[model samples]
Target: MPSFLGSLRQFVLAPKLSAVTFAERGFPGAGSAAAERLEAIPQAVVCGFEWGIAARDLWEVERRLELVEQEQRGFAYEGAAMAFTVRDAMAGGRGTRTRDLLLGPAAPHLLLAYIGIGFAMARLPRPLWRNIMPDLTGTLFYPTMTWLAVDGYGFDLAYFHPEKYIGKQRVPPPYPWEGRPDYFPRAVDQGIGRALWFTGGAEPETVTASVARFPSERRPDLWSGVGLAATFAGGASADGLARVRDAAGEHWPQLGLGAVFAISARVMAGHVPEHSALACEVLAGSSVDDAVAIAGRTGASPADADDTMPLYEQWRNRIRAELGAISGEQRKAS
Candidate 1:
């Protein structure tokens, strides 16, 4: 049974599973298989969150998540991670539940789980934000990769209020995350880019068109988000992914960088879905191992960088440039 606060959180925050359907969200291609898959992603997150918020023990959360299918189990973990983060934050920093979840069973799903922290960031107050994340300092992707939570916060804003953020292209004021206020909006834009994937029902052209509507300065990050979604959530086929890559044109490197990141996350999670495999081939033009290796070889510690362009951006630029060179070689060969 869920704790009282957990139930309250669920009642107030968790959406009805049916409510996330593409049709309900006013997304295109409501009845398509792609839409169905994309819709299920949010539903899984909600279910995990509901369970995590209410559970009396970590074992309770773990047991419930095990019931989810293997493919979506990571999403469930993501949800639980979000729940724990929110609960811990609300607790005023006395709990280690979020820490335990990530360092323990949830480590493999660290990518999504970290994004889950962003979900907490959205729901909690800014002051409480400090408590939302545990001490993940020495871990892989620590500190720097927490940029993903900013991404997640961006995704939540756009997803929950598309008309305001997505349709209107409203830019949220920047927060001094990771001691870098200037880069905050860019990270959020990347999340918005990810949201565009779902909002467009994974249609390459539709997603690309929506991206074009943004200011040219913003399109590169938007394209990067699109590439991550195309590679990870995958509502399209190989041809569709190819369309996204070509549509990216000058920002193709950003798109491929997103793909490389997606592949790295999936590989790290230890389950590469068939669709992800295809997206990697189409966008990154490489096998899963190579894509993951590319990400691995690109950057390491977030130990150094200027505030305007942090180590995180450095990592992304390196991946983007490497992908660009590879594509250049491919084009020359063809």
Candidate 2:
């Protein structure tokens, strides 16, 4: 992917750093520090995408990505993986760019890298999506984390085409992701929920209100997305996360489920930023260790009984049920 042409491609195809700013995108933000912090997330994505597209080798990309701050480094890998996926797709599925990324330098952050593939999915047509996710036969969370790519596509749609997906609340048609068209929209909503956290500028009132504008049934998935983004991305303070959690009310369990998933990803990355720890304590109502434990305890296996639901949905449902039970226990103790 390294060359003058590749650099030109990145320059032409990727968004400018300025373009990702909240104000540039017309997303709500008071220009507060938190808002600025939130805005940097996408900018990091741009940086990663550029580097990935232009680097001579995975080692070069990996070395360059190390220069990114720890908290945002995974995001750079995310961006790089995105570029890699696009390259692979463009090469008519012959390039090993994306597969090498996941199995090599981007391995630790496989979770975010999966989402990066989804971002590429949004850009490439349905036909090119065939071989995007590399075959990670014995990996810890291959097929499961692949769902995050669908989540990424949802985020991409809502992020770039707010008027259609977010404002008008259009339901995008389903793809048979992992052979489940019925669950595709639900997975996409999870990503849209994540985008809402950013679209509303990490402001609790605006984020929740945006979710509310969507139909009632959709709000739960949306809230969980909010929970995941608001936690993992960390634009809000402790107080702000608490407000986001409290705002969920009946949807609190869904929100907590999202937070738990975020925590699990962070933990797997082998680093937990201060904001994530705070989010776990506040939104997830547990320390990082406990949240990870809850996620692990409720984790579903492909062998889990009942052939009705996909393991991915079953995994989420299990987490929500655990969070719900924990919430119930607290209610009684209080």
Off by over 4 Å in 1: none
Please give, for residues 137-180, the per-residue lDDT of candidate 1 as tens digits. 77888877889989999998988889998889999888888888
Where does candidate 1 have its weakest 10-residue lDDT segment?
A: 300-309
Instruction: State candidate 1's TM-score.
Output: 0.96
| TM-score per candidate, chains pooled | 0.96, 0.96
**Candidate 2: stretches off by over 4 Å:** none
User: lDDT tens digits, residues 210-325, model 2?
Assistant: 98888998998999899899889988888888888888888987888888988898988888999988887888788899899998887777678465877877888888888778
lDDT (Cα) of model 2: 0.87
Backbone-clash count (model 1): 0
Model 1: per-residue Cα lDDT at residue 318: 88
- Alpha carbon lDDT of each predicted model: 0.87, 0.87
